[model samples]
Target: MQDTASQATRKVRAAGLRPTRQRVALAGLLFAKGDRHLSAEELHEEAVDAGVPVSLATVYNTLHQFTEAGMLRILAVEGSKTYFDTNTSDHHHYFIEGENTVVDIPSGPVTVHNLPEPPEGMEIANVDIVVRLRPKRR
Candidate 1:
């Protein structure tokens, strides 16, 4: 199996990202944590701690670029923060409400389909589904 660092580089390159030092480094940090959903601020801090020379803005930009290129999935878990996902497969998410965190929910054989067809002209590019859940009130 390929190492996480190598896999991150591969993923960015495969998504048409140049895989520059910054991009690779950022990807490495994100992918190193298995199945993580992190905020830009959190990632920026991690990257900073990892000695990566990327500014918070650059981190945000790279994250947006990765999401746009389908290398990552971005989720809005309320407030003004965005969460980035290393897993870009067709899957759903369960947002841990009060904790303000997200987790991938495997659909098994079932997939999200059967949405009404797109309007005449615009193409159907992608579908993002977020399921929010909070701790049960005792």
Candidate 2:
């Protein structure tokens, strides 16, 4: 328990973010489970259930702060629904449509080709490929 808190504090500080009570608590919940994807609302619910008094807005704010600090990546898999991925490495995902779940695709297996050149004065930052999936119908 104490180790998790300390680890979270160190992580936050390393990202150049202040390790506030809420930030540390949230970070603990986030990274403790290893690499995973979750939405702000889902995290907020976890916080509440864990007895952490926090608002949904704060969760969003902290998540954005982490994203800006490069600790997380924003994943938009579904319409109007955004997920934060703890694994910030370059990789792809498989989004299960009905289950609303995101699963990581192993690196190096998926290849992308034939990307058009960007407009003048603009370079591509990163490419995100989300392959939507559904159960085969009979």
Candidate 3:
């Protein structure tokens, strides 16, 4: 691992993650873009293109573990496969329908005006607000 990513791995290990080679490589790929969203397939393809020496299965497992560890947010796009978001802060996303791309929307002072309350026993784990949008036709 490089010096910069060694520090990153240390931080992730501090958060109770093992920081395995696969996990560290995946983390580096995710953080390399400086805040972006990518699907598992997309990431796997990128890794292969860059010759990162990781398998697709490892990508999926690392994604799941990283998500469970709160390192990334899982974006469940209705009627589509899930996307992994690099931004960890409280925010929403915009799904471009035909593009199959997700974009983060600023959640500043955004409050849910009308929403049903959660069930008595189950607590709110996440609030996924996705805006499916279409490009303006000429």
User: By TM-score, who's the top model here?
Assistant: 2
What TM-score do all the candidates reach, one by one?
0.80, 0.98, 0.89
State model 2's lDDT.
Answer: 0.97
Per-residue C-alpha lDDT of model 3 across residues 26-61, encoded as one tens digit per residue = 787788668899999999998888778998898999
Model 2, span 1-138: residue lDDT tens: 899999999999999999999999999999999999999999999999999999999999999999999999999989999999999999999999989999999888888899999999999999999999999999
Off by over 4 Å in 3: none
Q: Backbone clashes per model, in order?
A: 0, 0, 0
Whole-model Cα lDDT of every candidate shown, in order: 0.84, 0.97, 0.84
What does the lDDT read for residue 98 in candidate 1? 75
Give lDDT for model 1. Answer: 0.84
TM-score of 3: 0.89
The superposed Cα distance between candidate 2 and the true structure at residue 41, in angstroms, equals 0.7
RMSD of each: 3.1, 0.6, 1.8
Residue pair clashes in candidate 1: none
19-121, model 1: which lDDT tens digit per residue? 7888888988888777789999999999899788899999999999999898788887676778998887777788887788788888774466678988898
